[model samples]
Target: MTDEADPKGLIRESYRIEGISTGECRSIFVDWALSLGPAMTPPAAIALLIARYAAANPGHPMNAVLSDGLEAPPEARRRGGRAARVAG
Candidate 1:
């Protein structure tokens, strides 16, 4: 798998090479990436979910909707405890 950071950087490079704006290239790359994922890792899963949610909701802000409600990753949760429920 490609590094997550690299894809983001490639998106920026693609914009420069193709003469598109950064926003336009990012949108294109995001759309493409979201389509391919089964999202094995928590971060990847979150990213895919956010992308799909954003595509569907458009003007609605997903982070505001999820920020406080979602549990932190197991690694981030206190004391290596069981996973917490994320209320969505």
Candidate 2:
């Protein structure tokens, strides 16, 4: 049976790949994230993923990507534009 954090096994298969790059792991992670059910939150899912795989596969690239997922997102900033130049 599949785990709720990885119902489709995308993360599991990603770890099995030989020489999987961080970029590739990132891609697989996106798919995995989108596939998560509404009941799951990203951080909780990522924590589960790490707990499930990290000890046995410490060097796996997916681990780094998963950790990155838990970090707070960067501040959103608007670049210069017509709106920025205009005053209300």
Candidate 3:
């Protein structure tokens, strides 16, 4: 699997990163999710990530943060550029 699709390294690295806050990790995770190829779904990816990291790194701050992110509803996309007029 591509590095982007797999959360193992990312999770571990996030912990090793000095001064990396949960909020920063959340943003990183979002970027990682958006970079995924078409074959993967965000929900499925999130579930897998939780299963792997949450179990192994249960005490890690990212576990709870990532779990909450998974539970939260996806944000609505803001229409802009050519779609701005149509959105209004």
Candidate 4:
């Protein structure tokens, strides 16, 4: 049942790892997101992952991380630049 969305099985393995922490799940989620091809939307991939694994383990911490991915992404914010430095 491995899907192209999770080609490396990182998300799937996260589900199987007992006592995995939220921080670890977040790191794994980032890795999984970065692995997606340009054609794959993170929301679509995350929805698929939740459907595939969440039902079996409603308590998994990965579920929260994946669910968090579904949120509207924060708008890009500039951190540092000549303008920022000048303003500061």
Candidate 5:
């Protein structure tokens, strides 16, 4: 979402936070993505967030980090007594 209509300020704050590591920002990004409404999918949210901040905040670490996170494959997990790999 755009800064003007950012409801939670999570994206805006992410760009402004000082000395935040890529890992820390990634954790916060996951939380923010999860907290979004059911209607908003993770990929869509990531795209919106990238659009909102990437160009304007070019120097922000999140720009590259967020893109990398989106491209990374989902983690594997065990379910129903069997190991299952999540399809990205």
Candidate 6:
């Protein structure tokens, strides 16, 4: 199955296979940011955590479900937004 079809499982598996703690994961994410450009601020790191959590739980109720006539944030929307658009 694809990541979208089983994000939580993918995350758990990734963590297990990588032998990395959540803290380590967060640190690596920050390291990646630093390597790409500048050091990551606390706010940026928190945002990255939130984003990674969401990515690792795409089918989660909070991520997948929406109230009638209510729209998710542009970031959370399934299509034509930054993450999905970029992935596509």
- What's the lDDT for candidate 2? 0.91
For model 4, what is the error of residue 73's alpha carbon versus the real structure, in angstroms, after optimal superposition?
2.1
After superposition, the stretches of candidate 1 with alpha carbons farther than 4 Å from their true spots are 1-39, 58-62, 65-88
Model 4, 1-88: lDDT tens digits are: 5467797899999998999999999999989888887767888889999999999988899999999999997999987768877965
Q: What are the models' TM-scores?
A: 0.25, 0.86, 0.62, 0.81, 0.66, 0.24
* Candidate 4 error regions (>4 Å): 75-83, 86-88
Please provide, for model 2 over 1-88, each residue's C-alpha lDDT reduced to its tens digit, 9 standing for 90 to 100.
7578888999999989999999999999999988998778889999988998989998999999999999999999986888888985
Q: Give the 10-residue window scoring lowest on summed lDDT in candidate 5.
A: 79-88
CA lDDT of each candidate? 0.44, 0.91, 0.70, 0.89, 0.72, 0.40
- Tens-place lDDT per residue, model 6, 16-77, is 44344555544444344344323444344434444666576544333222121133335744
Model 3, 86: alpha-carbon shift in Å? 15
Model 3 agreement with the true structure over 1-88: per-residue lDDT tens digits: 5554454466557766766777888877766766666776777776777876777665767777777867867889977788777745
The residue-by-residue lDDT of candidate 5 on 1-88, one tens digit each, is: 5332234677678889888788877777776765666666667777887887899987778887678757869888657433345543
Model 5 TM-score, all chains together = 0.66
Error of 3 at 11 (Å): 3.8
Question: In model 1, what is the error at residue 34, expressed in angstroms?
Answer: 22
Stronger candidate by TM-score (2 vs 4): 2
The collision pairs in model 4 are none
For all predictions, the C-alpha RMSD in Å is: 13.0, 3.5, 5.1, 3.3, 5.8, 16.1
- Per lDDT, the best of the predicted structures is 2
